[model samples]
Target: MLQSSDYDPLTAAMRPPPGETQEQREEREAAEAEALEVSNRIDAEIKASKQAMKRQKKPIRVLVLGQSMSGKTTTIKNFQMIYAQKSWAEERSSWHIVICFNLVRNVNTIADTLNEETTDSILTGRRSSLTEWHRSVLFRLSPLRRIENDLKAFLGAGSSESVEIHHPNRPNTSDGLRDSPSAQQISPPEDAKRPQEFCIWSSSGWKSILNQVKTRSAQGKESQVPRMVRAVLNSCKDDIHLLWNDPVVQSLLRAKHGRLEETPGFFLNDVDRILSTDYTPGDEDIVRARLRTTGVQEYRFTLDKGTGTSRDWVMYDVATAWIPYFPDITALIFLAPVSSFNERLMENPRINRLEDTFVLWKTVCSSKILANVQLILFMNKTDILRRKLEHGYQVKDHIPEFGGNKNEFSSVLEWFRRVFRKLFTDNNSSLNRKFIAHFTNVIDTKATQHTLQAGKFSTSRSESMALRYGCFKVQAAILRNDIEEAGLM
Candidate 1:
């Protein structure tokens, strides 16, 4: 160990000459004090400004995209829920709005992860929905707040006593005005809660007074206080309605509106219950039960819970939003059914002429997309093929070992992978090395079966499975690599 007295290279180099003058040393010390004071002040102000900026800045925007029923909604729902829960714990303020349109309800087909047979009636913009009032309430809140001060100012109040419009409007009245007979009769009781619940005027009284006014008007007599009060209330209601109809307020309302509904536990409970029912339920029974349950319209319920977290997704169908603004879309989640490609590659005329029909892929590869485009192929309905392989007969004698029913599992996977790889290469690497293809049979027993049969669904699976898995794995790894290089997470 080195002693403190032992010469240190850094200290020696920084040391001043022993013969330095007293005046020079005094000047140096004064300069050093001034420099330290300046640095300290700068640091204090910088810290204060940083804290202030953090409070003022907006939350980061994240955009998500996936094909219809490809777990897109469920993904977003899960994300929103998780964001609320975790972000709440982290003390971070975050909010989300989901826009769903053109949904078809009550189909007889098997559903994906986050689909419901019917969306909430309010979300569908239909009257008679129980949640209609709730929908209106949410839409009203944001715009009301934005124009709260304006409304209060319009109603003859200054900024000091102005309340948020969502709160009850309390009119300022002096003690003399409160004691007046006309005012006491017209003003509501103190115990009344909301403006709507408290009747400002008696309907029967108003009717009688209005009749009196009409009768007097017919006789050429002036109308009284009752007629004037009636006119004032009607004018106020019309003003409120006009505020709701304002174009800027309406646009802001649309930007802030969202719909949420609870999911039924039928599928979650019954599926788990069925799994635990007997010591030995056959694979066929399992498959049939899944098909039956999946055919139910509860697919939408999952979007709100398990897979719902990914709903930050904005479908670019409406360019009126921010979709057109961000020219660099980093990734794309493409939806193409594995069954469609397998069963209809030759039969579907549109697909048969792939060069003519694959306009979306070509567009994605164009200069606009190529700068940042990354493709994720969601191979839907893989469960259908897995079931066929499990139950469908294999080629009999004289077939190679790779053609066996068990090997067909690998073979089927290979078939899809090869096709996707070929398509990628044929299209001049639209995704370049960033192309990833994966199979998803969300409602089927196949994913579990593939996991069980293939012993973890990794090494023993086809090159295609690897390629698909590689997409996510590689992206994640690249992120980690960047983080490591930056000495972050």
Candidate 2:
């Protein structure tokens, strides 16, 4: 090492003066010029590439879907941040091609209504099935009754302060009503301001019922039929406001004729497919499932993030809920607890009698959803293993690929590959199965957040890709490796 004695400490210089190193300076300057040229060329190439991408017009559409609380929202938001409005040049921009959907709200409402004997009690009297009563009430209830009532108030037809259903436009009537000195009286508000002419156009069916009830009363022949007729008329008059308030009914009237949309993404003929395991014949689950099975088109929305912003997203929540809506999705991301998987493997004494994980997998595979599905299973809470390992518990070697004691993470990855392959892969053909399955758990608050919260359910792109792309990449590679090993690729 050079000591202070080798150089003058007071000179504040360790190298030769500028003029003494002319040739070196020239070489350094030349190198910098070359570097500048390279940078310019690189920037030009990048600009051209961006321009090409912008000129391309086709929009990419990707659909992200899964069971509730399965990280679908997180995945879509991650994608949006990475791809939405990305720019390499001022004039070129990138658009994220992802949309996410959650069926929770719609499912919850239907599930709640059908949960007991309510539908059957009101509609069918079957005590289990949703009869016409359920359908008629749901259809007839006005969605826009509040707005329609406000409109009526504006028209002065019915209100808290006034009642003017009849024609009040006759000047004679106004003159008769108002009597005061010309100087002191406000000329009983203009008669012209009152409604001109009014007509209550009753339907033929309604009129017939009303006439029958009236005739019976006039003749003093009051009986069950007449009483029922009178009750019906009274209900119609009392609830007439509600009848005109229904959006569905109003739409029907306006269209003259049309159909409503109300289908879920999946459907099953057997009620068991939707009803919980504890469901019984008289239970609400059965009733709701029946309605869902029979109902027509339903409405569902797709949610996605706005480009480049974490605080903003577009919500496509349809205001109405109906039946038999949404098309069958192609992929499923199944999420389950890590402990649950282990319990099934160990056949834990406490939860032993419950459905085992493997059996559960088989059942899910057998569901109609699997007919065109690629499952992405999230074996979440792997962190649980660290604690379990300290207790001398071991992950059984039978499913060793799913992460045993050694290299647990890699093992988990491999286990996913093998299991997915076995379920979906075909042995005799080059066709690799279209289905994919993976596992994960939602342990963090981010995972717990609802999809609709403006700033909730956010996760880092790295975290998302760790499972999303990691699963895709490894599974795809495994398939390719198998094919090549078999001389099929």
Candidate 3:
């Protein structure tokens, strides 16, 4: 009986005046419609807000992929130099080891060549044991041994390091492998101090190499002496420079047919200043420095979004079929070296480097996995190509295509541009994708810095474009979530 009175349908707040006019009723209905419209707009805005949160949570990831020595790593280094300098400084020590190695290996090669010529049984060509000269040259190059030893110790190779390596006894030595040294223990002094903290500049390792590498024979001061060991002859540069110039050295180079002059990373032609006692690697030196990226490496940095706004960015240094692919790839930056048009692969001397780039480009462009992903092609190493053309190196000599084409740099560069542009255009008509490319001398910071800015702008545009397409999907997802929550089929 109390409940019937307590629950009143016609309460004071809900009451409308009796004998209300038709105009008032119409106005009341319009007000209710306005409220419903406002409610719908709020619900739409809430759904939009959640979708925006999802977009903001997902980071933009760019991948740098290319063959070995095609300037892929240099492009990444350029990005680091522009965005992250502190990280670059910390990793500079590793380069010192590479520089030292080049010098020692070249001298040993020279000494071996000299000893072989003296034997002149070059007929049997029976591998020379040649212990006497090997030991002599090994002892001569002992000063640089400290840096190598430190590298091994730092890399956790564990003592059992050797000084005098019998090249034949080296385990896992790859043919034509100029970079790796085998561990054949020669007599290292007992109870030596542990490697003094991986700092080559402060360590006496550099000083010893400079002191020990003097050539007794300097018949003439002509050039072409240092060409053979140009890749590894940075340490003890002065002695090696003269030694390389020596007639005997040149004679050995001519006999071996070692054409070190044309190749990139032949720093023996220039970059001597970095060998000095107090030298630090300059931006250019680091770019030109011969450190092949062996595996995938991730680099992260904070992007300058705007005043009072910023975001974190990540980039991956990726690989190819010869190298593995990056599973974390979001966007692709493919570097095609223009200079490689006339060059052969270090891995397979039979195949042209540019040909390999074309195969890689096709693989990346046609991949179903990356069908809708952003793709940017970087036509890198333009500066080196310019030098090659000016110095009279003809492309036709190496590549049979473009028979009798004008040998001028611009004309030749245009030809390559057409080749790349036509490749994606003709093969994948259904994709209907426009190919974008940039001419970059990647080692040049100014060029790559501009290129990166453009790349970022293009990337953001692509992400927004993707967002437009993802809008419907996101709305459907929200509706599904609501249905599940309500237990509705």
Error of 1 at 251 (Å): 48
For each candidate in the order shown, give its overall lDDT on alpha carbons: 0.32, 0.31, 0.50
Error of 2 at 100 (Å): 29
Query: TM-scores, in order shown?
Result: 0.32, 0.26, 0.56
Q: Candidate 2: where are CA atoms >4 Å away?
A: 1-304, 307-327, 344-355, 363-369, 397-409, 426-441, 445-489
Q: Write the per-residue lDDT of candidate 1 for residues 1-489, one digit (tens) a residue.
A: 788789698887757768879998888889879999999999999999999877652322223333222333233232323233332222111110000000000000111101121243336765432234434433433332323223222222222211001111222222221122221124344443221110112222112222443454568674343233223323333333443444543343332211001011112112222223232332222212210011002111112222223332222211112345645434444544433221211111112111211333433434343444455455544554465456552322112222344437667567555555655655644433444555554332232432332212332233323333222212222222222232221
- Candidate 3 Cα deviation (angstroms), residue 277: 3.7
**Per-residue lDDT of candidate 3, residues 1-489 (tens digit):** 558869777685556668989999888879879999999999999999999887663444667677666666566555555445455565554455445444344454555566556586556766544445444544555554454444333323232211211111112212221111211112223532121212222122222222222211133432232222233344456565655666656655544533443333345544366455566656665655543323356666554422122444466666555223545445567878777665544333444567667766777777766665556677776777888688787777666665699999889888888777766665543364446565655344443343343322222333211111111112112222222232322
Q: Is candidate 1 or candidate 3 better by lDDT?
A: 3
Considering summed lDDT, which 10 consecutive residues are worst modelled in model 2? 93-102
Among all candidates shown, the one with the greatest TM-score? 3
Clashes of each: 20, 33, 4
